[model samples]
Target: MNRVPVSSSNLSSVGYDESNQVLEIEFHGGRVYQYFDVPQRIHQELMNAGSHGKYFHRNIEDKYRYDQVK
Candidate 1:
């Protein structure tokens, strides 16, 4: 997955795989996680949001199944 860097205190970048509904998020402390069963719209909204970290916590975090990548 190709992640795009974002400006966020808690988040670093994001990547999405639409075919498999996987959303990958990289955090500032080098922790990376992949969320499963994510909708493309949620990924789009997250990328477009002004506060990526806030959006992730409020919308994506704990909402989908995920695994730590790094």
Candidate 2:
């Protein structure tokens, strides 16, 4: 997946695989995680949110199955 760098204190970049419904997020601390079964709409909202980290915590964190990619 190709991740685009974002301006977030916690998140470094984000990527999505629509075909497989996977959402990938890389943190500033170099931790990378991929959330399974994520809808594209959620991905878009995260990208557009005022605070990506806050949005993740409120809406995405612990809400989906995930794996630590790195």
Best candidate, lDDT-wise? Answer: 2
Q: What is the lDDT of residue 43 in candidate 2?
A: 98
- Give a tens-digit lDDT track for model 2, residues 1-70: 9999988999999999999999999999899999999999999999999999999999899999999989
- Taken over the whole model, the C-alpha lDDT of each candidate is 0.95, 0.96
Candidate 2 least-lDDT 10 residues: 5-14
lDDT of 1 by residue, 1-70 (tens): 9999999999999999999999999999899999999999999999999899999999999999999989
lDDT of model 2, residue 16: 98
